[model samples]
Target: MRHLRSLLFVPGDRPERFAKAAASGADAIILDLEDSVVPARKADARKAVADWLASERDVPAIVRVNPLGSDQIDADIACLRRIAPDAIMLPKAEGAESIATLDSLLGDLDAPIIPIATETPAAIFELGSYRACADRLAGLSWGAEDLPAAIGAATSREEDGRYTAPYELVRSLTLFAAHAAAVPAIDTVFPAIRDESGLAAYVARAARDGFTAMLAIHPAQVAVINAGFTPGAGEIARAQAIIAAFADNPGAGALALDGKMIDRPHLIQAQHVLARAAASLLPSEGGAFSKAFNRSKPHTTSSR
Candidate 1:
């Protein structure tokens, strides 16, 4: 799949909102069958998700199946076998073993996997193992909510909504792990849905810290996430200028660019910026998020 800037989550049991989520201008939609769905409704949710995936979709559809070792995962896999989604999001993923196990269960079904890499304490220690199964991964993401509860912490964040010391460490580890695996690093969700300013700042920080995409709990955050990840006009121009400077100095190890010294590393960074700029344009060119900002109807569903 193309580099997704925003992946919105919709409850699997709430089939009524599936269409809305598809039209929410998000790069992809995640049909959540894990913590979002109650245990009693697991079967019903599975059936509902299967029915939806049976049809065609413009936006990429990813199903967040129940974690490994759970009874629900077997049924979830059975449902996926009937109609596979574009990708699968594995929750509470421990390591390469988890990805390998899920791949074996998938058999002939060939959807890419995006694992929530940090949920349990054991998962933290296993981050380095993801490089082993990197080929099977779409991206690597982490969860703050589940990890805090799993470790018996009072909260993952402070009063300002910033992640505490322990949570920050895990977040940084997840970022490095994703890079080590040679895949895109996806940032976790910002749960405070109504705080638009906070969401924007968080998105900017995620982009600054090298996260290519972010998880969205609500449809409203899609626009902000998309804008934050996309390179600005000035950024694109600067990147182009840097590339041109390198081109002018063919064999030079270091060159002056607007009075500052730039080397091969700067050239590489400039190339990456241009690549991101190109990827950002894909969504608006007959992609799912083309008309995202045009819709005026506000979504009211609260994210869990």
Candidate 2:
């Protein structure tokens, strides 16, 4: 899970902002080329991404390209070879065949793929196939804007500040699809950059609904998003207690601990909390407390 609690989206056309974005406290950054860039600025965006990939990108950079069969696909590939990013974001992926084509094209290249299970109605039906991408497939995310428009919806949001019924179906399905395929389910960006409290609420809702991460359109949202997903110090302490108690009784599936009946499921949940803490310890752009969750050094040999 690599503590990708907050994935920030930076417009590919803004080359000057790229480095600043990389330096932001976000765990990973996506350089967006699809919706964010204007049609006339496509070339300029592509050139900027190519240059950044080649030299300037400092963090775990993901370059998102146009759809699979689009005119700019080849150009996207060329930039990939030049810049060599941690992953590539594929838009409008309908099923396994599209991923297979990307895998075949990459052939032996090591860059992973992050698919946006969004856009058209057909994509929603075949979303589960994205998990077959495996190691080269980093995560699964969705976009409400395109999908809602494709389905002829007035807006993705409802009066209660929630996704409309159709979009909600897609959102939940994408989460299930990601889980079924054994990958991280990343929630889409919240468009309201100025609403910090609203952003936190949305991210909290997403986390509760099984999303491991959420995309941030602005750096100001990063702290709130990260905070929303991460287990606080108090939670970490509780998880640690459960783990220690479980370790003390290896053969016991259930035990009474601190007045609660802690069982195997509790232990499993505790381990997940600890694992998340460990990943948060990576060289993230955030502060020291960010690494406080990462207890990786004491036992480096053990897999996270």
Candidate 3:
């Protein structure tokens, strides 16, 4: 579908919160069956999520199933077979092979996939391989929490909440890999839910670093994420001016706009800004997103 500026996660077991999350101003809601739910509750969560998805809903629903090869995955897939979500969020995804594997398990289900691409150590090296299965992807996102635990690190970030060097490397790799695969680069969740100022700064950095959207842990963070990703009045005005200047000189490679030299690259950037602005204005209902998912098919390619 269009770029999701914010995707709020709601625990699959907590069905009571599903409707609240759908109305939390987020572009979509991720029914988390992975990290959020306890092992004892996975089956119940799957049933709850299936029941919810089986009914009609206004917002798009993306179910975050347990990681591949886990005992819970078979049941997760079975639940999906009963009632398909708008998309599947595959956690601990390693690359094209991971996507291909999930696609096989999904069978005829036509939901799109969004992989959390950098959760394991081996996944770091597999980032570039996503290009092989980009057509099956909705976007690519990275997580810092699991990586640090996987590597036995004390923490993934510094005292200031900035990511350490290794985590930074993975983050940048995930960003470039998404672009290389021609998919949206989705930033990871900001864990400090109460730190609104910090969240704003993180969102600003994500937008500046070319992230099309961000994950949200709390409903309070949705509005901030949406506002951060949407173009401001000044930004929209500049983008419009750039487009007008390019239009005025159809065959020119470069032109002066408001006393500054603007080139083809500038025009392309302006177009992207306008596109994001327009996407932000679209209705949050699931009609458009469901149609987009139905139209999507797994890209046929040999597993890596």
User: Could you tell me which 10 consecutive residues in candidate 2 have the lowest summed lDDT?
Assistant: 295-304
Which candidate number would show the highest TM-score if scored against the true structure?
3
lDDT of 1 by residue, 1-304 (tens): 2458999999999999999998988889999999999999999999899998788777888899999999898999999888767778999998887887887888877677899999999999989988777767778999999999997899999999999999999999999999998888999999999999999999999998989999999999999998998889998898999899878889888998889999989889889888998877765322232222121112211111
Ranking by TM-score: 3, 1, 2
* Best-to-worst lDDT order: 3, 1, 2
Residue 18, model 3: lDDT of: 95
Error of 2 at 260 (Å): 2.7
Query: Which model, 1 or 2, shows the larger lDDT?
Result: 1
Q: Model 2 residue 159 lDDT?
A: 79
Q: lDDT of candidate 2 vs native?
A: 0.77
Candidate 3 Cα lDDT to native: 0.91
lDDT (tens digit, per residue) of candidate 3 on 1-304:
4568999999999999999999999999999999999999999999899888888888889999999999999999999988878889999998989988898898998778899989999899899998888878888999999999998999999999999999999999999999998988999999999999999999999999999999999999999999999999999999999999888889999999888898999999999999999988888777445576454454635346
- Models 1 onward score TM values of 0.92, 0.88, 0.96
As for TM-score, the candidate ahead, 2 or 3, is 3
lDDT of each: 0.85, 0.77, 0.91
- The C-alpha RMSD of each candidate to the native structure, in angstroms, is 7.9, 6.5, 1.4
Prediction 1 TM-score vs. true: 0.92
Q: Give the winner by lDDT.
A: 3
